[model samples]
Target chain A: MYTSLFYKEWIKTRRPLLLLSAVFAATVAYILLNVAKLYQANPVALWEFIVQNNAAQAGYLKYLTLGAGIALALVQLAPEMQNKRLKLTLHLPLNESKIVGSILWFGIVALTGLYLASGAILLAGLTVYFPAEIVSANLLAMLPWMLGGLAAYLFAAWICLEPVWRQRVLYTIPALGCTSLFYLDALPGAYLPFVPWLASLTVAGFAFPFYSAIRFKQGVQ
Target chain B: MNAIIQCENITHYYGNRLIYENLNFEVMPGKILGLLGKNGTGKTTIINILTGFLKPRAGVCRIFGEAMERLTPAAKSRIGLLLEGHIQHTYFNIEQIEKFYSRFFPKWKREAYYELLKRLQVTSTQKISAMSCGQRSQVALGLLFAQDPDLLILDDFSMGLDPGYRRLFVEYLREYITAENKTVFLTSHIIQDMEQLIDDCIIMDYGRILLHEPAAHILNHFRRFRFTSDADEIAPADGTLWHTEKVGNNWETYSFASAADVQRTLADGGAAVSGLAEERLSLEDAFIGLTGKY
Candidate 1:
């Protein structure tokens, strides 16, 4: 049952997943090429600037990661919302929670995988031109952005699964408010001290979709 | 025999407006029951309640002896649901959908699904989203057939089909139900199609169930009566008559009473009647007669 559920999710989401992967790969490559140009101009100056300013060269990644989360959520969940098609999923001969869980689980796992690959590529590219301190600072800066992506994905699911428009609007407020915390400062390691809080917020966001699913099942209008 | 589906005193409201109150009905085993109602009379509401999508304000609905709101996965396996407009997961192609659903049911009839698809004349790789509404309906029906469920709950199955597809659906469903003796509870705006399919019916009015009986009984017993009367105003003295109206000197009404009883009741109401006639009605005519044209 779980395999079939994932298979159905995969069918609905594979196209968007592929499209997002290509875009993310292209964006990461572009970021790496920019950093390489800076290193070629003056490697010593680039290293000193990075060490002194504590900045991650890849600022474009912030919105790319966030946009990927939002886009993936919309593609994965908006179809289910159309024509109340989620009823088909709920009607399957399985536990309703398990069905809902498997759907969210698939999106979360897919997003996590994409984020991991993109982050790994970014880190590996930086390692070739910079020392450990610069790479570690980049990693620290990127972690919160990835957590923000996860939070955005889950929040989008909550809003999309919500059956009523008024409630969905209300949900969007917190969705925006909460995800904005990850972008308060762009400098490398700026959010490192608050990483645990940001991660906690992302973890808590997973529960919101289940609440929306419950309302949907109750036929709230 | 236990009822295949039962609703006891089901009451529900939309915010402050009452959709229905203390509504009750049951579908007996092997009986094909149709829920007939004018729009906004809570037909879909009942379907939602029965399927555990909408929790009612009061009362309980049980399917296969389990509460609908808490149906076990085993219980759900025995039921097939067709939503309004024959909605399905349109993202998957014909074959992919079949493969996706086949894993859930132990008694999945893959041949049954493909057999119906062959009639659609579409390739297995064609996505359901690309099909016309009628074609989508057939796919939904084909999926239901493949599930091989014991109970089928269909909501407004005739909403978006041409006559040919509607006839095909009704005929195919009739044959399947008869051959398998499956219990079906369904509603359709097209009462003529339902007339041919339903063995029993529950006609609903605003906030209540107006009538619940076998379709054969309703057709054989209930009738429309038209008579020309000399009196200026004729009215039924009792509640037996439904939707009594006067057009010129001609009076028409629907009732379950016999011709003799109707004549007596009119005479008692002080009408001098002539050219009294009884009209045997189709289910659609009977429905309008019972519920009125308004």
Candidate 2:
């Protein structure tokens, strides 16, 4: 049942998601090429990239990996809510947590895939143009950040979609706060887990709201 | 007959606003219960709560004697529901929906699904998005029949269907009920269409159940009485009160009980009476009488 929900969500979202992915890939490719050119033409840009990204690998991972997670999260749920299709799913004599959680799971998987593709392109650019500071450990360390971002994204979705006005506005404010954290890129690991505004704004994202089966029970008869 | 569904004081509230309160009702085995309600009534809300789609604020409900919240596999297996609107993943063809649902419901009968597909005259390959509104509505009914449930709950039965399909569906449903002794609960705007099929009806308004009785009883006991009353309104002590309207110095009152009590009262008041005739109660009249608003 869980897998079917995921598969259904995938079938519904795969087209636009893949299309957006292709667009994201093109944009990332452009950014990577531009970064390489800046490094060769004016060494100052090289110092700037190092200063910005090398400070904390989590910050870079939180923004890029979480951004990817945000896209996937939106791809999974936004249309369902907009079209009121979630009612169809919830009406069935099934567990809402798993139904909603399965969509979240698909989003996490999709984001992980995006991270793999984007990371490859970024890594290749670093290897050819500037290999001085790009380490494999630094790359490996971004996994927690990616997972954390995914959790935060799902958490925001849960709170925002309470099917009531107060909860709707309630879910909206926290989401705004988290997205702001992602944009600022200065959020530390200690604060990331609590950032309900987004999926990747925290340390492990699990702390934000990890599909607490408790929530669905209260709502359905 | 055993009650397949029972609700005691089932009250539902959205935030602080009470949609309905103190709702008590039941559907007995081998009986088709018709839910009659005007627009904005809580008919759909009750269905949603029973199907476990929406929660009630305070109430104890049992399906097959098991609490709804528990919703065991055995209990859930026995219940089937079709919400007010016909919903489908428009991009998916009817066959795809059939295939997907077949996997979900453990007791789903493949042969019955095909049989219903033929009976409903729906092509398996027709995508829901591509189908006309009426065809999609038929497809929704097709899915419900495929489940072969013991307790079936439907909301707005004839909302978007043509008269021809409506008659065919009712005929098919009648046979299905007789053959299987299944319990059916339906809410619809057009009570006339279901007048022959439903065994009993519960009239609802503003989330309140105003009346519950056998369809035959409603037909036999209730009537419309037109009389002239100089007073603004006359409240009769006895009989089922339906609705009242003032025309000039006269009043036309529709009552579920025999009009003898109300007619005698108006005559006792010494008001000039004419058109003192008994009118047959249409479903629309029964609805208006029960809800006051058309």
Candidate 3:
């Protein structure tokens, strides 16, 4: 039954998933090509640039990482919500949480795998670019960013279903609040990289599969 | 025979309006139990409650003698439900669904699915998104019967089906009930389609079980009664009777429970009780007679 569920997921999700995988491969290749072009042209200047802008570079990567999470939520989970096909799985004999969880986790794994493959290619290009550049062992040692993208997507999907049009305003409230806190410089340092909305998405990435699963088990009338 | 499905006083409320109140009924095993009501009479609500889809506001329902909320996998495995519309993922083709369902339903017979597919004219390779409404309905039925459940619950049956498919469906349903002798709990406003197959019926109107009995018994007892003058209007059993409007100058009252009791009441009311006969009732007529207010 579990395999069947996963198979169903693969059949339904294959197109978007394939397109994303292709995107991952292409983007990584381009990044590697750019790194090689700069390294061979001016090795001294490229090494100095890396040392000077390491934080900015990491920040940019973090932003890109966040984008990955966002894409995972929308691309993988949103369509199911909009189409209302989740009800079909919900009505089935399987546990609601388990089914949704499996789907969410499945997307997470796929996104992570494709992204890591791209990153590895990019890292090889970086190694060829400037061998003498100071590589931060500590920053590299930090844990992989938890892509709670699937979770957020599921949460947003759940919120999106409410019949009330005013419920949409709920999105703006969080966005505005987050901006105000960031402007005030009150944002905590440890959680700086993982934005609240992203965190919610990540949380949704984890929690929604279970919660939605329970709701799914309730079945459709 | 033991009741395989029991609805123990299930009362549901939609905002301020009550749908069904203290609706008590039980469907015996291997019996075709039909639920008959007019549109919006809460038949679907009752069905949703039975399948554990929509939660009841007041009481619990039991399937195969166990509470539906606590339904075991083995219990759910034995019951098949086909809702009003097709419930499969449309993105998937018929072959994919057939393959997927083969894993989920333990009793799912692949040979039986294909057999029904052939008989029903459903192609396994047809995508659900591309199939016409009639074809989709067929696929749903095919999946349902393929599971070989002990209890089959069908809601709003014959909606999208063309005449040919309708005939085929009825024939198959009739055969299943008679040969396998499984319990069928079906609800539809189109009562005549399923009326012939039903041994028992549970009905609702104005948020109460207006009638619940064997189809023959309800037909035999609780008929249209004609009475002349105000002096002839007899009190019915605790106000359970319905008044069916005028025929010439006399008033007609339809009362349920016991014909003998109703006959005695008319006799005691000091009026002419000359017209006493069973009205040749269609399921439609019985529906209006019990539920309609004149």
Separate DockQ for every predicted complex: 0.86, 0.25, 0.38
Candidates 2 and 3: which is better by TM-score?
A: 2
- Against the hidden reference, what TM-scores do the models get? 0.98, 0.81, 0.79
Expressed as tens digits, the lDDT of each residue in B1-294 for candidate 1 is 999898999989999999988887889899999999999999999999999999899999999999989888999999999999999888999999999999999999999999998999799999999999999999999999999999999999999999999999999999999999999999999999999999999999999999999999999999999988767776779988888888766889889999999888888888888888999999999999899999
For residue B44, give model 3's deviation from the true position in Å: 2.1
Off by over 4 Å in 3: A37-88, A131-151, A157-205, A212-221, B120-122, B220-241, B246-278
Greater-lDDT candidate between 1 and 3: 1
TM-score of model 2 (CA atoms): 0.81
| iRMSD (1 decimal) for each model | 0.7, 3.6, 3.2
Worst 10 residues of 2 chain A by lDDT: A208-217
TM-score of chain B of each: 0.98, 0.89, 0.84
Residues A46-69 of candidate 2 have per-residue lDDT tens digits of: 758656765232233446555665
Worst 10 residues of 3 chain A by lDDT: A179-188
lDDT, candidate 2, equals 0.67
DockQ winner among the candidates?
Answer: 1
Per-residue accuracy of model 3 over A56-77 as CA lDDT, tens digit each: 1222233344455456555555
Candidate 2 error regions (>4 Å): A31-64, A82-84, A128-132, A137-148, A179-221, B13-18, B111-127, B162-175, B227-233, B247-251, B256-265, B268-275
